[model samples]
Target: MNLSFSKLFFVLAFVFGLFAVMVIAKSVLIPLSMALLVSFILFPVVQKLEAWGVNRLLAAFLSLLMMFLILTGFLTLFSTQIMNFSDQIAGFTGKIMDTLSEVIVYINGNINFIEDLNREELIEEGISWLQASSGTLLQSTFSTTATLFTGIFTTIIFTFLILIYRDGLTKAFVSFGEVENQDRIFRMLQKIQRVGKQYLSGMFILILILGFANSIGLLLIGIDNPFLFGFLAALLSIVPFVGTTIGAVIPVLYAFMSSDSLWVPVAVVIWFWAIQVIESNFLNPKIVGSSLNVNALVAILSLLVGAAVWGVAGMILFLPFASILKVICEEFDQLKPIAMLISNDISGDEKKAAKNSMWIEKVKGWFK
Candidate 1:
């Protein structure tokens, strides 16, 4: 009984400690998380520039400039479309309300078996809740926006400093007093660098493919702001599971609102569905491989927990961070069990099977 009680107490304490860490991470760790993600994304470009005979500092600066320009250009190009989409929300809400009313009327007229549905009461309650929550929600949104802006600024500064002094940083990590410790640190850094570069590069390629596919589909379906929708889709695709679905809803809803025919929205949905299926089954395996090997369930859970902890930034950073943890765990024999639990190694044959499956799919795709 004493041992059982102690174990229970320990579990409860651990849970509370995790919650406290998450809360503290929102303010204290978010910027550093963002910085790490940015650094990972930029690392490959800097390395490529270095390979082409540029100095590390110059290469890093150029890579940073390029990233900033790309971001600025995307925002500039899509600003009007985003504004228009936001402006149409009131109309969309009204239309959805009307649709709900029509559905309720249809149900009441057709099914006399269930008369007391209380649709009106439900609608009223929903509206009342929305009204009550809107002010607080808006205030919370603005606060979050301010925090995000500050975090981004800090991340940018941190990323620039890290990149500028990357060589010195590496040297410092590798110059520990003990040779074994120095070697271990250097190896760890190398592993992290390789994993980070591969993850970022694979993600970039996947996003680019998704963006182009989405744009073409939207265009073919006669959507108004195809480019903007594609951009949004690409951005959201960084997040796992729900991201693609959320991305689809925007374009489909836009189609519903703008187009007179219901078929447009239906087509948009089908298009997104097909694209997502292809991405999941084919593209992801080809691009990302089983190197980072995080399990889908863990990835989704990490995304949710990260979002809860640090909002969108956390959601964006969570997967790679989790992947890094898995890598670290895998590198140490004592921690390999935990790594296996988190990784996509359910059958122990995952790596070999994934490679074979990827090649098969690639061959099929090429022939088709």
Candidate 2:
């Protein structure tokens, strides 16, 4: 009893300590964690380049350059579109106001009490609140942007160094374990690296597929800036369930504002719905394959926990983190039970088979 109590206490304390560190050290941890995953993903490119007689440092640099160029191109495209749209901000504002008025009228019609609500007074209160919060919001926005850039820069540098010295890092890690355990550690690391590479690549491919599908659907439905809305939604879809809904709102809002026909927004909903179905049923399972192996419930919980700890970064990082943790748990004999508990691979079929086998053995014993 005492031993079990002690173990429970220790485990709870350890979990709390880990969460505290994650919350407190997010600035450093976030960049470092990103760098680790990025390095893992890029390692194969570096390896291939090195096999072609390129110097390790040069290969790593080339890999980084390729990534930077692709990123720059995407950012340039998004920014240019945003700047062009900004030129018509006044028009958009008017449309927004009109939409809000329509919504207010619709609601007031449905509710007698709401008919007494003064729209002008509500608008005035909202404007006053915005004015009060504007300075703080602006400051926060600036700080967040600066931190984001800093984190990206730091991640790039760390990823480069990691790629260059990956062999040394592996050797150093292996040296910490006993000689017999060193091989197991190396195997564990390899599994982790494979999972990281496959997972990241799959995510990238999934995003592109979603973006293409969404853009095509929107274009067919006559939504303007289809690519912009589609790609933005694809990016948000990285956050799991809430992200797709959030992304869908942009095109839906545009449809509501720009179209005289009521069917436009309804079409927008159908388009997103179809894409979501395809993505959930087909693209994810086929492209991502068995790399993540995190079930939906656990994945959602991890996203929630990660968001609570590190906001958006947590949501992005936690899935891969869970994968690595599962690998570690499986590698250690004492932790096998934990691995089973967390693994999505322990599916219904496997459990059913195990139960059937147990029943067969019990029947056989009775016959004997």
Q: Largest TM-score belongs to which candidate?
A: 2
Top candidate (lDDT): 2
Candidate 2, residues 1-368: lDDT per residue as tens digits? Answer: 12356666787999999999999999899999999999988998999999999999999999999999998898887787677556755477556655676677668778865646776676666567767998999999999999899999999998999999899999998898999899999999999999999989988988998898898989999987778888989989888777889999988988887788999999999989988888888887777747887777778888999899999999888988887888888887556555555677644697766855664554344323
For each candidate, the alpha-carbon lDDT, in order, equals 0.79, 0.84
Question: After aligning candidate 2 to the native by TM-score, how far in Å is the CA of 132 from where it should be?
Answer: 5.9
- How high is each candidate's TM-score? 0.76, 0.88
Candidate 1 residue-wise lDDT, 221-267, digit = tens: 88887988986887788877778889999888788877789999999
The per-residue C-alpha lDDT of model 1 at residue 167 equals: 77
Clashing pairs in 1: none
- Determine which window of 10 residues in candidate 1 has minimal summed lDDT: 359-368
